[model samples]
Target: MSLIPSESMRPHQENVIGSTQLQFDQGSQPRLRVVTHTAKSILVRFGIVGLARQWPSSQRQATILRYHSVSSAGDYRSPTISVHPEMFRRQMEFLSRHYDVLTLDELVSGLETGSLPPKAVAITFDDGYKDNATEALPILARYNLPATFFVTSDAVLGKSAFWTGWLHRAVSSASEETLRKASDSLIGGMSSVLSREKIYAALASQVDHAHGSKRQQRFLALSRAFHHMPPLSSPSDFMMDIDDLRALLSAGMTIGAHTATHKVLAGLPEDDAREELSRSKQELEQALVTPIVHFAYPNGHVASNVDDAAIRLTREAGYRSGGTSRRGAALVGTPTHNLPRQGINDALGFSGFVFKLEEARFSLLLRGS
Candidate 1:
């Protein structure tokens, strides 16, 4: 399970109200989602977040936003990994207008010196998506915001396609019946009733834990199974090439290593985990001809995809900092090797973005009440 909260499962209600009032409140949207979005919008509009930031404790904490693809043509297998360009632009504009947007390095430095600014945020992208360069970079440059791109080294080398993209294309292209048949042949028979999301999860879970070479073999086998299916609707270059990395550097963006093959580090042996970290850093450094100082766990859910072993190996492998999918703010005393990050995606619209920036605080108040 991911550390990030599921929007569908989370409920939001404001004030004690009767069924009639609740019906009125719900309007056209789903009751929980409408209430949640409305509640968050109200909080932001009413200066509640601003007032919260006045607290000394709030001032000491900073946010790092994690993103993957930024394009309208998003991944069919995982909508949460993609944010539409327009929404992303609006988010960048909001960050520029309301927060002190800093690079990951700067935010880490502030944490070290205990000098983090109020409302400080850092932007990051994982998986080296081509859309990061094609879509996100222009918007970021428009806002003059700096972000770190953590590229899986194998993807950049073109030795193999990013497994997630390959998986996305294969899974999205096929029908439900086709998927079940393929799953039976490749792994085992999946339940016919399994939804696309569950099927994707089942397949991804398999891919995520495998060794790099084995992972590729599995992905290729899966791809071949779906070969008769029509291609992805929005087929494009999924991963960044070496030149794209150079372009990001020239355009004033930071490059970091996401690991050699983007395997879940916690599942691997210590030596394998260490190799994933060190080798990716070595390869990225060699390719970019610059030091790769930062790292991010592949699945990055603390204690699940990430653990003490993974964190220790990250430090041993010579990373200055490591980002995770653990959902919280990075406080002054937070571990440098296991910094918490909030994942941002399409489902989290502008209102959701506002809420997520201060989600830790909001969740605390909600829980306490």
Candidate 2:
């Protein structure tokens, strides 16, 4: 009953074929990538994004890039989520310089009509972080890239920090050494694991599996599980308010629903899932005075958050489109509610940034974490 797409049930052949070709292309370069560190990237650079250019017709590469928070590197920053303003600026500039920035509607139209321009991309942000309005928007406007924000209605309307924000703050309080040990202890002991990304993913998986205080307890326990760092409690640790969302709409940005409380729909019972979708869409429309047509799976990964049931609920709620956080090429032929996105983070650096924009390993290496 899971809403996430399965391998055998993958919705689109064109999307899969392009994804496979890129994986095969990148498959032979592990040693070369390890040796030069820059060799594969050099190919991506000179090849004019060989991933997109090499794709056959009916499989045009239209990547949907996913981001979470953008700020000046304080409480709002997460190891997996936040991107610095400078880096964001550079990224936007790079995208504008090389590619055509498309709106969600534009991407869908291209997908439906097969008229997608080469080097096409769409930008999106998750969690409705306030900094997205304050810090990220100015830069986005400066570059004039059309973007979409999928927000959790409860967080914004109630002005509360997301449960995960507290967890990140707790982990951030400890040194990397402490986090590694804690995760090893809690998550079945992996020797090579260092960062908290996998542990965080594990913690997030537990979120929607239970409800009410059980959920709160899980978050708080995870918050305290690390080196006992206090949770980051600043007001900045929340989604954009109504004013912020409306302003973005006024600025010509699109908005999407991320559920009522950012719950993982796959774990919820049918009625709960239905409420999360329909209610959040209603709330967004009422607040922003615009129809909410798109939805992003809370975690958007097959194993963690989404499943086929979630997809069915999404359609039940009447969203025009939905997507997963899994890394891969954004293909037009895929199911409208199951597009794949490449995750963007600071770790990718400018070259990694370029490679991601290149969508080089999208199907091979996309991670929601």
Candidate 3:
């Protein structure tokens, strides 16, 4: 028998006051009843009953999973952003077994038309890392799964930045003591009890300094002063090159713009934001010869410095969709331009990945709650 009415239901009255009563009057067996005199009790019961009626089904909603690097060794360091190559393969195997792996275009179209299939997922890689081509592509190809990449155009052509190369090196080389000292130097009067996690978070925040341009420079200066390190000859030391990008595109994978310089768009003036968005899209389109319709914010958090004006500008520039670092399922009817994606890092194994996907699906069913 149907548990809840098929149509969306609303309460008979708004601002319901006084002692409210609920009686499950329609049933073949003994019905349940609850009585509440307090408003909080009534509201709580109403929510519980409503949620009980709209519980998530075994059938899943469409989801898009995001990844950064795919490497076995380095992945362990950043468990939230990188996955080991073998683990990635296991994830693919699991998805193949249970879900229909859709391409980015297919997912976008499904979202537009409200015809997305159950248990559907799309895979995406961010930052255009070289390991993605060397490690991730082969695994995806073996599984016959199509994936999308959001590329930073400058990095593709070989530009070194302080953040990508220096910050990484700093964290990797610094003794725990050095990290604490560096943190104090950068953020003045910061706590000495900073853990490695807090240190990394502070470094990441600097990625938006100078509206994203000086991120590399800041890292280089800090690394040189603190660790006595020499500057890298090539900024692309930590990123994929143009050839790597082309190879991925040639292998039937998709590429989208991640901005020209990976700047946090919200911090810039409108003109600067427009330039960054438009230029990155133009550069990528010129390189790949494909319509660049997707964009990913450099840092997915909502920041006072990031310009929301840029997001609007991206839509105006003809992007069909964009991705955020937010954790949730991409609902079938959600706007393609502001979609949320779950990150697939080392912390998520085969089981954790499944749990996240299920969580996203359940969240979708409980929408408007």
Candidate 4:
């Protein structure tokens, strides 16, 4: 009567049947009752399991992969944020095996019209790190993949107002105790167990204020108090120089502006915001000899801390599109003003990367349906 067999019955159905027959001989009526109940229970369990397995709820989604740098261990504080060149090659190889990789422009066009292909992915890099030229470009070329690099123009040209350089040095040079004291000094009696990761997040939250002259000066002073160590013998030792940018341009990668001094656009006055956006765009175009059409916010979050004026400024500055670190696939009809991209860290291995791509695609399918 039952559809599912017990574990004991799994190996030999004939043996279970033979044993039940033998038990029945000793007590006919009771044996019949037991068999009836057992069979009915198995039938119900089997039916439920079959129905659950047959139901359609295990499909995957699509997502884009965004990276910051692919560099040597010496250059990066977080290995997850910076994929090694070999790992980068492997990741791309895995992607090529399973998905259709799209260029930035193709993905943007598809998103504008709502016509993305199945299992499509786009790759992006941020910050224009020098190692991007030294490490990432060769690997990308091997796979014939095109990527967009968002450059903070002042940083690319070796200027010092960008907070990342100071932040990196602070994180690299300070002992755990010194970093703790610095955090306490800035935020006033905060806990001491804060890691560099947490400190970076806290500092990023306040970087929007760097657009204001007074606030910017205040932050610079605070950084000096906390992070300024003996200046590196050469400032260009840490960042990509102008010649490095030229090498990137020559390699067929597109460069997008990430603001002049990497200040959060929304936190600055309208005039200052305009200057950051316009000047960065103009500088990059002049350096690269091409129209720089895309932009990314310095910290990439505009929800709570950044103001709408920044977005307005970018549009007015003539950028064709901008990106944010929101986890979603680029879709047709997605606003050019607030395109969402997935921020990838090293923790996302080949399997994790594949799964995220599926997740983004699945969301798009659901939207279409």
Q: State the RMSD for candidate 2.
A: 8.3
lDDT of 3 by residue, 1-369 (tens): 222322233233111224432222222111122224243343334443324223443232477898998887651135457788889889888777767789899998988887777667899988877788999999988888899999888777665442454455556567766766777777663546765556666666765656544755665657654564445444655577878878888888889888887777776777888887899899788876788888887777464433457658779878888887766777667777777787777765454566456554432232322
Which candidate wins on lDDT? Answer: 1
Candidate 2's C-alpha runs over 4 A off are 1-37, 45-59, 173-202, 211-213, 216-237, 360-369
**Higher-ranked by TM-score: 3 or 4:** 3
lDDT of each: 0.77, 0.71, 0.67, 0.62
Displacement of residue 258 (Cα, Å) in model 2 is 0.8
lDDT of 1 at 133: 93
Give a tens-digit lDDT track for model 2, residues 129-148. 88899988999999888999
Q: Could you estimate the TM-score for every candidate?
A: 0.83, 0.76, 0.76, 0.75
TM-score of 1: 0.83
lDDT of 1 at 270: 83
Candidate 1 backbone collisions, by pair: none
* Model 3, C-alpha of 328: deviation from truth (Å): 1.3
Q: Please give the distance, in angstroms, between residue 170's alpha carbon in candidate 1 and its true position after superposition.
A: 0.5
**How would the candidate models be sorted by TM-score, starting from the highest?**
1, 2, 3, 4
